[model samples]
Target: MTTILLLASLATLGYAAWYLILCSVSPWERCRRCHGARSHRTAIGTRRDCPRCDGTGIRVRIGRRLLDYIRTEYRAGSQ
Candidate 1:
């Protein structure tokens, strides 16, 4: 039981770390106009309005709910 739980925990931690990395590197991170630029010229697919620099040719994306699931998992583990 302990080994199983340990392996599961390790897997979860690895997944969480990967998720965090993806989120942090996601083009849609906090609407930054940097390398991870959102594919769309406009925020048509996103729920929020396009970032301010949209008109000026700035690609930005805000990651929505990326960490929410991981956070939920972490919270659940505590219980």
Candidate 2:
């Protein structure tokens, strides 16, 4: 009983840490390949938008959509 509960708590905490490492509520990291330029030079001597960043030069983390939803709900409740 007590032992089981302790194991469960530790498991939960481990899972939470793993989740945080695997995901992020906010992603502000710039695209390394494009260096935030949103465009790069091609082998053909032509410039093209970065495919990895979809020309945005920024990537959204997995949990950002959830954070946006929560923020919207909080704002609605506050108002």
Candidate 3:
């Protein structure tokens, strides 16, 4: 049981690292709700830019931001 748990934890960590790396390299993805339309229908029957994306139809790559932050911190630490 302990061995299994250890393997599971390691797997989770590996997956997290892979996902962060992918996010660091991947482009911004479209907002799911707007499907890249950059707008959505409001309750008043008017269209408005998606609040999540501000009508740009894209969001910042969280992984990339995280990677940049880590890099900055490491540089500061090294200096």
Candidate 4:
């Protein structure tokens, strides 16, 4: 039981560190809805901008958004 718990904790910590690094290095990820295409094809063969990413084909990482929120809150509190 203890061994399993230790392994689980180590894995969690490793993933958190990896995600933190990823957030800092590349804070944007391809949009899931458009698969980075920036536009979607309709049934009539017309293309339209991806609604999810607003045609940018990229979205802010959840971790980055969380970090931004935390920073904002800290700044507000400090001031």
C-alpha-based local distance difference test score of model 3: 0.88
Worst 10 residues of 4 by lDDT: 42-51
Question: Global lDDT of each model?
Answer: 0.56, 0.82, 0.88, 0.97
For candidate 4, what is the lDDT? Answer: 0.97
In angstroms, give how far residue 61 of model 3 lies from its true place.
Answer: 2.7
Clash number by candidate, in order: 3, 0, 0, 0
lDDT of 4 by residue, 1-79 (tens): 9999999999999999999999989999999999999999988999999999999999999999999999999999998
Query: Which segments of model 4 are wrong by more than 4 Å?
Result: 43-45
Across 52-78, the per-residue lDDT of candidate 1 in tens digits comes to: 544333433333264666778999999
Best by lDDT: 4
Which order, best to worst by lDDT?
4, 3, 2, 1
The TM-score values for the models, in the order shown, are: 0.37, 0.45, 0.74, 0.91
Q: Cα RMSD (Å) between model 2 and the true structure?
A: 5.4
Candidate 3 — which pairs collide?
none
Residue pairs with backbone overlap in model 1 = 27-36, 28-61, 28-63
On residues 1-79, what C-alpha lDDT tens digit does candidate 2 reach at each position?
9999999999999997776665563456688889889999999989999999999998765566566688899999999
* Best-to-worst TM-score order: 4, 3, 2, 1
Task: Tell me model 2's lDDT, rounded to 2 decimals.
Answer: 0.82
